[model samples]
Target: MDYLTATKNKKYLMYISQNYSYAILRPLQQEILAQGGEVKWFLEGNEVTSSFLKNNESHLLTIEEVIRWSPDVSFVPGNVIPPFIPGIKVGLFHGFNSGKRNRKGFEDHFNIRGCFDLYCTQGPNTTSRFEQLSKQYKHFAVKETGWPTLDPLFNPDTKSIYTQPDDKRKTLLICSTFSRNLSLAPKLYQTIKTFSEQGKWRILMQFHPKMPNELVTKYQALENENLTFIETDNVLPLLKAADVMLCDTSSILLMFILQRKPVVTFCNQDPGKHLLDVTEPEKVEAAIELALSHPAQLMDDIESFCQQLHPYQDGLSSQRVLAACNELVLTNPKLKPKPLNLIRNLKMRKKLNYWRW
Candidate 1:
């Protein structure tokens, strides 16, 4: 019997190690449940808050429990998944590539960790690169299914649990990456504080979870009538509410730009015509003004950039992802097998204390 035909009740495991994974995989989970598939979550580390899991959502607490559950497939948003997990491991990346480089100066986004059996790429830029890597690795498959996280961003009917502030002020969202060297949080602090003091825009500041608590506290202190600091795992609502975004090299900026809205980025690593890249803190105010103005050329560049990044506006990427997974299972492509990855697997086993082979 074919894989899809034989499986009456498909069991899917959402393997998460970070808080952001919840937002990335929830849309896919919704699709799974709608299709009569059983979906369970397996949170590997303390970083992922258990409370985020809904009452109806099931979670496997231990590795032993996961082994017994025997899922048909596992979706991982983070880089690594234990090879011991009994499933076809699929990589659902946590975020878009924001041109951040690793310590070794290599593009971290395209780095293959020898774990996933398949990669559901976001768009043409990522798909073309992963396709090239797929050819070289010959171990995994690449499918250009849009990122599932943005399903709600594109879906107008989807009601957000988050309520934007009632104020009618033009919202200016400020976000920064956690990377110290790449972050503009510290550098642009005075400028943003001044902006809040002006009370011309409603400043909504949110930083990456991994950002230093000291810096977070510093920004939190800037809260006043004009400024509000937001802390949440899901940033979709904020993306929709904001008119203009001021960011550093964080991938969240990419998500904001996908709305075809203008963004003012500070010293972006890969500055493009799509963004209003400002070098100095003093230039930020002017950049924000230009972005808010929505210049004809700038808006055109943003639209063109978004097309290459994520063209799917239908919000049905989750369905496409499921279809891709089903097709892969049915075909059972004869690709090169994944590496043993003994060191990585050993580290994972030690972390989980699962020794049974």
Candidate 2:
């Protein structure tokens, strides 16, 4: 912790993610500054998300601008690790554990490598996954500090998804999945449609970012008043307003637990492998169905079963993340091969028995 704490007075670099995450990081940035650490943000866009920096009373410099500022530690989030910035230390604030059954396609493609002077991760499982992937390629230097992105969800929500009669009220979520290994989407939609038609529930749609806007517009046009379509980049606020979350394998469901809402994962794998290779369509479907068996109440045992689902969601996650970044910077090696071997290797196995955990 000292290694990370040493950044008490250092000027750190941070790669900005979506608008939602910026809010969570703001307080941490304040703490960093209060301790004499100066923070520079590498934001995605200058529109809405960046606007919060002003209220948080923080500052954001574009990547191009940050290059000129040249801080001691560069923290990376979701975007492709930036190109070479001469004369700067790199600290990786990694977002996704790419290369596993849980990782999304865009997330798995471009991973920031060992070039990071320091690497911070979601947790041990993620470290393990990177290690396993390294066995097939390069080594990784990573520390598990949990996800700072979930900082906003640790606290219980002030409200529920809904309190109306469970059978008559519905909370529909527009959702997406990481890997669809079975014929689950259509069937899952059928399940929701059936439930709604029976006056048991309503639908709210939360579309993925990568999805085409026109497609979302078309889906939103579905003639259903009970269905509320989420079009904004920020979905957490909406998730907070919801009661029951319906989606297929979105990491967001983990956040939904903060709302005490139940989750339903939809798989559409008709004998296809979206992840690297290993996938069990039947088991995935069975697990999700069983978890949602409480059609009357969502997430009957979510808090207890969170470990199997997320594995690294401790509430004070941001502080751990800071420690991880600092640890990497202190121990980070230059141009190491197989930077992520151990982690990737352990988690390369399928997520078959996890739900049972």
Candidate 3:
């Protein structure tokens, strides 16, 4: 029997680098708690704030505190596993957009650099990719558990399509990746502004947490009655709230696509026929109108695309992830000591302002 079905309690430790990581682990944490499992969160870096602690009700753990705790499993969304931590290190992934490219071939999104003992993949595409990498690297395991961050989206009772009052205006969510060259924010700001000012639509803008501060400030100044600037780490609510999402080269586009809503991508690195691809900033307005006007035309394509990402729409993805982790704990009872990389650890410690001995 799985931990959820078993009558015993287990412990889960979450390693988070930023506030946005909470979205990826919150659903899993809820599931773990529901299954008589306890979870403790550790902030992995020094750039934390008092406001984060107050909002999350979690304390920051030093490297010593983390080692002393020695959790059964450590869930991380970022790449670094943090040297000398005990337990099964699991990478839950931050996003599903893996088909893009950097100067290097294939962009290395799903590449396993031995950071995780197990990876809870969002869907088949990611799983298949990681499976190949795992075979080649001869370490780590891949589990096809859908992303926990999107679990709330599949729940009917908790899913809210609109947070705003019923003004009956069409809602458009604008988002972008942090890449300056790939992001559409700089190129399409004027176009978005023009549309928002028309009063025909309600614009909700949520940028990547890594987006440059100056760009965030510039967009913050654009907030008004029709346009809302979202700065929160949790985007599940915003993802559910929006009628349509406008983005560029973001896996978030796939999340919105899973909603079966229309998505307009501006200069996406991996443009798909399922999405309305706008290469030019000038064409974004027309694409928005096209999406809002005839979303039904794209329903079949959207569903097909969603299936490739994740087959589950029943909100049990978090449960599946927990099941996978529990299976790892049960089968691999002896914890393997993660090999220490002194240079890497020291570099990270210095960068995050941890004590260097």
Q: Highest lDDT among the candidates is held by which one?
A: 1
Clashing pairs in 1: none
Tens digit of lDDT per residue, candidate 1, span 1-357? 333333338888999998888888999988888877889999997798999999999989999999899988899998998988887899988899989899899899999999999999999999999999999999999999899999999998766543455777788999999888889998988999899899999888889999999999998998998898999989998888889999999999999999899999998999999999999999999889889999999999998998899999999898888877877776789889899999999999999999999
Comparing 1 with 3 on TM-score, the higher-scoring candidate is 1
Span of ten consecutive residues with least summed lDDT in model 2: 269-278
Q: What would the per-residue lDDT of candidate 2 be over residues 21-101, giving only the tens digit for each residue? A: 565465456556755778877665443366556644545454446656777666555433443443334333423432224
Model 1 weakest lDDT span, ten residues long: 1-10
lDDT of 2 at 224: 64
Candidate 1 ranges with C-alpha deviation above 4 Å = 1-8, 159-166
TM-score pick, better of 1 and 2: 1
Model 3 regions lying over 4 Å from their true place: 47-50, 53-60, 159-162, 295-297, 333-342, 349-357
Tens digits of lDDT, candidate 3, 52-156: 544544554576676677788889988777655777889987778636775777566765556688888888767787888767665677789898888888888
- Looking at candidate 3, what is the lDDT of residue 97? 61
